[model samples]
Target: MPLNKQFNKDVCRNLFAKDSRRLFLKRTLNSATITLAVSSGLLLPIQAIAAWNEVAFAATNLQTAIKSVLGTDLSRASDKISIKIPDIIENGAIVPVTVSSTLKEVSTITLFSEKNTAPLVAQFELDKDCIAFISTRIKMSQTSNVIAIVTARGNNYSARKKVKVTIGGCGD
Candidate 1:
């Protein structure tokens, strides 16, 4: 190879090596810091995470599931709460759903499929500054009403939409 070409190759190889080393070092330091922090009780482990509602998820009926999750069976229909979902779902395995609310001080959003064996689909906790919106995929056993309950300022506001599932998602 020409002397100039060899020199250029060497320079490029050195630059690549330096970049790799820098990245490796950065990742190592980050891992070490996190390990130390977690060991010293400054950070909690993943297994220590809480706030899972087993009863809600295992509830068989809509009212039971709602009461288990939100501590109230009563909810008022609200125009401010919006549920976006397809009128007809070809496959029940993955139904796209979006729930959003214009209500202020929204704390939580819970989703339920009335026909599912276990009615409670998902629940999300929202921070005060965060937007009252949740987009997720849920499985349906059959054609059913998809309900969204938004908890704001200690009141439950709800909206539901009918979804026709041609093929059951939860093993018909």
Candidate 2:
């Protein structure tokens, strides 16, 4: 039962010391493994993706501008995109427009008002991997066609809706 009885005191003491040394070595090795992983770039967190591109802003007409940005013709009506606006904006100081696309792999989305002097209001650049979707506010000179153009995977698509203004909110 007693190691000391079977072996000499010095020998038993040596065996106990050897076991303790092995434990220390094991802990040190484990710590070093973690350090190596971080140094080798295997433990870093990924950065957030920014989806946006700044491209040409040109459109003679709403459709042309939509084409210039998206590179394809839009559907007559699509179930994929939904454009939301007030039936009548009593004030034009700040008109809200919301555009959402159910379509997959959308690259960019833009909004334009046909009647405005400069029809091209805003251009959105979706990063290469971003799906098409956006919401924004645009100015309207009068009751006009507010167009929503979406670019997805190098193809162009869009939707349009006419909104009525009870009062001239665009500082007429």
Candidate 3:
């Protein structure tokens, strides 16, 4: 073989050998770390940090749902909270809804479709540093009031808007 060709072949072999060695080291280190974690009980099954309120979500009636979620059926009307939703919706399945609050220390925002089988549509938990604003889509069973309850400073404030749905999102 020519000197150049022989040199190229040797270089290619060395490159491949180095790559294989690097790969073997990486795989071995990864396996060892995983084994250590497993043996030391550091790799535990995922446990939910937040608990789900089954009763609130499962409530069929608006009053029951509100009571379960908020610990009471009563909420004071507040102008500080704004609900942006179409007065008339063509489709009930995907109704655009946005809830924003100017109230301080807003911790949670819950939505309810008054006429749905399950009145509770969605609930959001806000962090201390998070903005008290949420935009989402909710389903409406019929033409009914879309209520938004905002929890701020351990008190509940509410706002509602009447939404007319031409087609029901929830099954009739």
Candidate 4:
């Protein structure tokens, strides 16, 4: 009777071993599939979020960043482009700015601060169906000149405003 009980236990162990091996293989395959998906950047639904312009964002000055983003440094100062921002801000952390263009066929609007560490602040891409206007809050390191560049029909138009900041946004 003892020998029979021992033999039964050994058979049960052998039967469960195959199930554990299968489970291990299944777990390994699932892990590999997830790794591949993440490596290929398929986890994000929007592809544009992953696509970043390094040159424009990494530029240290206003001119370089503008050239990197707009492909040219020459922009004509336009009266048709209106920039609405406070001349003086108590806190540099939240500075409201609105840019509107009366020019036809506006394609893009880009904002910059001349004295900021990285000047290129924000950019808005517009199509024919949309209006040529953008409003947003941007941080200013100190008292600097804020510039708005509008691109319309292959021509670049610009407007600049000087802002006085009482408190520096860059923790100065």
What is the C-alpha local distance difference test score of each model?
Answer: 0.94, 0.71, 0.93, 0.92
Residues 1-172, candidate 3, lDDT per residue (tens digit)?
6999999999999999999999999999999999898777777444325577899889999999999999998899999999999899999999999999899999999999998989998899999999999999988989999999999989999999999999998875
Put down candidate 4 lDDT per residue, 4-77, tens digits, no spaces. 99999999999899889999999999999988987787884575575667999889988899999999999999
RMSD of each: 10.7, 14.3, 9.7, 5.4
RMSD of 4: 5.4
> lDDT score, residue 168, model 2?
56
Can you tell me which runs of candidate 4 are displaced by over 4 Å? 1-43, 48-50
What is candidate 1's local distance difference test score?
Answer: 0.94
Backbone clashes per model, in order? 0, 7, 0, 0
Worst 10 residues of 2 by lDDT: 47-56
Better of 1 and 4 by TM-score: 4
Q: Any idea what lDDT model 2 has?
A: 0.71
lDDT by residue (1-172, candidate 1, tens digit) is 6999999999999999999999999999999999999898877766588668999999998999999899999999999999999999999999999999999999999999998999999999999989999999999989999999999999999999999999999975
Error of 2 at 151 (Å): 1.1
Better of 3 and 4 by TM-score: 4
- Candidate 3, residue 109: the lDDT equals 97
As a whole number from 0 to 100, the lDDT of residue 134 in candidate 3 is 95
Best by lDDT: 1
For each candidate, give its TM-score against the true structure: 0.74, 0.58, 0.72, 0.76
From the highest TM-score down, the ranking of the candidates is: 4, 1, 3, 2
